[model samples]
Target chain A: MWTWFYQLASPKWFYQFSNKLLPWFRAATFILFAAGLALGLLFSPLDYQQGNTVRILYIHVPAAFLSMFVYVLMALSGGIGFIWRIKMAHIVSVSCAPIGAIFTLLALITGAIWGKPTWGTYWVWDARLTSFLILLFLYLGFMALHNAFDDRKTADRAAAILALVGLVNIPIIHFSVEWWNSLHQGATISKFEKPSMDADMLKALLTMIVAFQVYFVTVLLQRVKAEILLREKLSGWVKKLVTNQ
Target chain B: MYFQSFKEFIEMGGHGFYVWLCYGVVLSGLVSYFIYSKQLAKRNQRNLIKFYKRMDARSQLNANNQLNANNEAQ
Candidate 1:
C-alpha cells in the first residue's frame, strides 16, 4: 500500500498513468452519459405533483451531489498534502477547486430553475441553499488564496489550511435540510431501504449519479495531469513528453 | 420513447422549458470544461517545448559569447 502510495505521489508516474487511463475514462464517460441521459430524459417517469419539472433532477441532483463530493475530495486531498507535504496531493487539491466550483454553479442555477417551476420562486435563504452557496464561496476563496502567493509551496500550505478549516461546512451542507425547516426536501436515497421513489426514477437517478461521478474522475485526471506537467516542466521526464510526442 | 412525438417530448407535459434549460446549461458547462481542460493540457506541453527551446537558444548564445571572449583574449 505504501509502495502504491509513493508511486501515485510521484508526479511523473501520475502523468503517465493518467495518460494511459484517460482513453478508458473518456470512453466510459461518453457511454455512461449517453445511457444516463437516455434513461433520465425518455424512460424516467414524471413526478405526479411536480410534473416534468422533476426531470430536472436528472441533472440537478447529480450536479449537486458532485459539487459536495468534489468539495470533500478537495479538502481531504488538501489536508493530506498538508500533513505529509505531498506535492501531487497538493496538485490534486488545487485541480479540484475550479471543477467543483463549476459543478456548484451548475447545481445552484439548475436548482433555481427547478425551484421557479416547482416552488414558484428562484432564490431562497433556506439553510441548504445558503450553506451550499457558502460552499461555492469556499472554493472561490481557496483559488484566490492559492494564487495570491508567488511561491507555490507557500500558496499550497495556505490554501490547504483554508480548505481544512472549511471542512466544517460539508456536514452542515448535508444536514441543513433536516436541521432547519427548509423548502428543500430531505435526501431520500438512504442505504438501508429502497428509496421512496419509483424504481424507474431511482434507476435513472442512480445512473445519472454514477455517470457524473465517472465524469468527475475523467475531468479530475485531466486537470491533475496538466497541473503535474506545469509543476514538473523543468524536470527531465516532462521534457520527454514534449520532445517525443 | 415515452412521449408520442418529438414535439410532445420537447413540450414535456408543459414543464419542458425548465427541464430542457437545466440539461442544456449543465451539458454546455460540462462540455466546455471538457474541451478547455484538454486544450490546457496540450498548451502546457507546448509551453514546455517553448521553454526548452528558449533555454537552449540562450545557452548557445552564451557558448558563442564565451568563444568570442577566448578569441579576443588570445
Candidate 2:
C-alpha cells in the first residue's frame, strides 16, 4: 500500500498514466459537451418568468459550480502539500490555481450577462456577487504569489498557505445569498434532498454539470502532465521518453 | 425542440442576445483555455528536446577535443 502510494505520488508515474488517459478524456469531454450543449439549448424548457434568459443558467450554474469546486480542490491540495511537503501535491496546487481563476471569471461574466436580462442591470455589489468576485481575487492572489518567489519550494509553500487561508471564504460565498437579501436565486439542487426544478431541466443541468466536471478533470490532467514533464526533465526516464518520441 | 423552428430557437424569445452571447463567450473561452494548455505542454517539450540536443552536441565536441589533446600529448 505504501509502495502504491509512493508510486501515485511519483511524477513520472503520473505522466505515463495521464498519457494513456488523455485520449479517452478528450473524446469524452467532446461528446459530453456536445450533448450538454444540445440538451441545454434545444431541449430544456424555457422558464415561465425569465423565458430564454433561463438558458444562461445552464452555463452560469456550471461555471459557478466549477469555480467553487476547483477552489476547494486547489486549497485542499495546497493544504496537503504545505503540511506534508509532497512535491507532487504542490504541483497539483500549482496547476489548479489558473484553472480555478478562469472558472471564477466565467461564472462572474455569465452571471453578469444573465443579470442584465433578468435584473435590468449588468453589475451589482450584492453579497453573493461580491464574495464570488473575492474568490476570483483569491485565485489571482494565489497565482501571483506563486510567481513572485524565485525559489520553487518557497513559492509553493507560500501559495499553499494563502489557499488554506482563503478556504474560509468558501462558506461565505455559499451562504451569502441566504445571509443577505440578494438578487441571486438560491440553489436549485440544494443539499441533495431533491432538485426544486422540473425533471427535464434538472436532467439538462446535471448533464452539463457532469460534463463540466469531466472537462475540468481532462484539462487538469493536461496541465499536471505538462508540469510533471517540466519538473522531471532531468530524470532519466523523461530523457529517454523525450528522445525516443 | 422547445421552439417551433430554428429561427425561434435562435431568437430565444427576445433574450437571444444574452443567451447566445453567454454561450458563445463561455464555449470559446473553454476552447481557448484547452488550446493554451496544450501549447504550453508542447512548448515545454520542445524546450526539453532542444536542451538535450545542445547537451549532446556539447558533450560530443568535448569528446572530440579530448581525443585531439590526447593524441598531441602522445
Candidate 3:
C-alpha cells in the first residue's frame, strides 16, 4: 500500500495520469454542470420567502464548501510533503492554492449577495462570514509567501508550513455558526441527516455539488499539467514532448 | 423554464444581474487560466530552444578553437 502511494508521488506518474484524466474531467464537468444548473434553475421550487434568489444557493453553497474543503486538502498534502519530502505533494498543495482562493472569493461574493435581500444587509461581521474571510486571507498569505522566496524549494517549504499552520481555520470556518451568534444559516445542504429542504431543492443542491467537484477536478488537472511542464522543462521527456508539439 | 423570454431569463426575478455576475466571474477565471497555461508552454518551449541553440554554438566555437590550436602545434 505504501509503495503504491509512493509511486503516485512520482511526478512522471502524475503527469501521465493527469494527461489521461483531463479530458474525462472536462467532459464530465460539462455534462454534470449542465444537468445541475438546469435542475437548480428550472426544476427546483422557488423559496417561499427568498423567491428565486434562492437559486444562488446552488453555486454559493458549493463554492463555500469547496473553498474550505480545498484548504484542508492543501494543508494535508502540504503536511505530507513536509514529512516525507515528496515534491508531488508540494506541487498538489501549491496547485490547490489559487483555485481555492478563487472559490473563496466566489463564496464571499455570493454569500454577501444572498445576505443582502435575505438579511437586509450586504455585509455583516458575523462569525461564519468572518472566519471564511479569514480563510481567504490565509490563502492569499500562503500564495504571497510562496512567491516571495527567491528559491523555489524554499518557497514550497515555506508555503507548506503556512498551509499546515492555517489548518486550524478550517474547523473554525465550518463550526462558526454553532460556536457564535451568526446570522448565516447553518449547514443546509451538507448535513448528513435527512436534509431540511424539499426534494427538488435538495436534488438541485446535490447536483451542483457534483458539478463543482467535476469542475475542480478539471481545473486541478490542467494546473498540475502546467506545473509539470514548467518544472520538468529540461528533462529529456519534456524535450521530446515539446519538440513533438 | 420560469421565464418566458431571454430577457426575462436575464432578469431572473430581480436577481439576474447578481447571478449572472457570478457565472461571468467563473468563466473569466477559467478562460484566463487556459490562456495562461498556453502562454507558459510557449514561453518554456521558446526558452528551451534558445538554450540548446546557445549550447550548440558554444560547442562549435570550442571545436573550431581546438582545431586551430592543433594546427598551430603542428
Please give each candidate's TM-score.
0.96, 0.93, 0.88
Q: Write the per-residue lDDT of candidate 2 for residues B25-73, one digit (tens) a residue.
A: 9999999999888777778888899999999999999999999999999
DockQ of each: 0.78, 0.73, 0.39
Q: TM-score-based ranking, best first?
A: 1, 2, 3
iRMSD, all candidates? 1.0, 1.0, 2.5
Off by over 4 Å in 1: B64-74
Residues A152-176, candidate 1, lDDT per residue (tens digit)? 9999999999999998999999999
Q: When only chain A is evaluated, what TM-score does every model earn?
A: 0.97, 0.97, 0.96
Specify the poorest-scoring 10-residue window by lDDT in model 2 chain A.
A1-10
Among all windows of 10 consecutive residues in model 3 chain A, the one with the lowest summed lDDT is A186-195
For model 3, state the Cα shift of residue A81 in Å: 0.9
Q: In candidate 3, how many Å is residue A64 off?
A: 0.8
Per-residue lDDT tens digits of candidate 3, residues A27-99? Answer: 8887888898889878888788887788888889889889988999999998888888988888889989998
Candidate maximizing lDDT: 1
Q: Report every candidate's CA lDDT.
A: 0.92, 0.90, 0.83
By TM-score, the best candidate is: 1
Tens digits of per-residue lDDT, candidate 3, B1-74, equal 56678887778778787677766676566557645643554576677777767877999999999999999999
Q: Give the winner by DockQ: 1 or 3.
A: 1
